[model samples]
Target: MEFLAVVMLAVFTAGYLVLAGADIGVGMLLPWLGRDQDERRLVIASFAPFFLGNEVWLVSAAGIVAGAFPGLEHTLIEGLYPLVVMLLAGWVMRDMGLWLRGRVDAPRWRGWCDGAIVAGSWALALAWASVLGSLLVSAMSGGTGLNAGTVLGLPLAALFAWHGAGFARWRLPEDLAARAARVPVRYAVSGAVLVAVAVAAGSGLSWSDAAAEGSALSMTAVTTAAVLPLLMAAQGLVWWTFRGRVESPSYL
Candidate 1:
């Protein structure tokens, strides 16, 4: 039952990573991909449908950790208190930017909000990556994992950028969408290389390690290793199904 709970938690975490990661990635790329107000609106509208709902998985994951693995939760919170605060602050700032962008007419004000959106998204991505990297390092070494996590910020940022590009390709239109289509391949390849390096640099724990131990950590690791790929595959299929030019909405 504990193993099952851990596995369920991993599933929620994977969902958050795919869904919310893409949302954040979209925010991160708004300034880069959006040349004008209409283009920027399209980029923002792409994920607007599910943006708030997607965060449920993050909350679910955190709740599971606090409920099921209280000790781990305590440790993680203590070690990453600043990051946790920053993550929350970033989200709040980004949300404000998203909402205010539509309301404001002043070019200078909109530009400032746009910059905030990107900065907030970048901060969130980097903080999340650092936390995961630290946890992975600590999991392997049975010690504090702060430094390695900080080091992993770049690749993860690139990975999220790739994610956003994939989304733009699926949801944007015309030359904008075509341009987005070209972005993912480059970032995906580079991000994959960096991730490979990170994995290789670590202690290289395997499925066998999970199977041998039958512990909570092992269950989480095994579940994540098995499930994340599947989630990503499904995300790709959804994108493919929705690919090509964005259709005009009935309201529009």
Candidate 2:
């Protein structure tokens, strides 16, 4: 029963990662999305279409956390004080940016809101990735597993910021894409390393555990083998296909 529930929760978590993750990636790259005023307008419009609905997964995830695992809620939230705060704060900032973009009058003023949206979205991405990385790197030991209990800290967050930079690569105007890409490319490299380390840790845990209970490790390996390369290739193709094109988001 517990196992089934956890597995379901993990699946839900993955769904959130794919959808909301892309949404964040889009925002992080927004400032770079266009070369000229028209392109930038299109970039902004790309977000405008689906901005509000993209976060439904988040709400669903929270409901699952609060309702499904009520017992773990207090402990999880209390122990991860800073992370929870940042998560909510980032959410607020990003959402506020979306709202304020509409209400504000001037183009220059709204541009500031767009900046906030990008910063908040990417900041949230880094924070989330770091916590997940810490979870992977923490020492996994015997009876209580207190070592694994703590979330991954700054190093992982830095890694996330790095990969997020990679996601920025294609989002900008053709000219800026290469320039803005330097940071995200580095970020992606670091994030890839962190994810690799996490995989290694899981493999080690699977080998050492007496009862062979590391289903999480098994699933992670299977998913990584199946998914990561495909995503890399797909993203590359996307970049190649759209290389010099302006933001005609009608195709999106």
List TM-score per model, in order. 0.73, 0.59
lDDT of 1: 0.66
lDDT of 1 by residue, 195-249 (tens): 4544433333222222323365555545655766775576567656545556442
State the lDDT of candidate 2 residue by residue for 126-219, as single tens digits: 6666545444554344221223433544444444434434544545456655655556364345444644544433332322222213354345
For model 1 the local lDDT of residue 143 reads 61
Stretches off by above 4 angstroms in model 1 are 184-252
**What is the model-wide C-alpha lDDT for candidate 2?**
0.53
C-alpha root-mean-square deviation, candidate 2 = 7.8
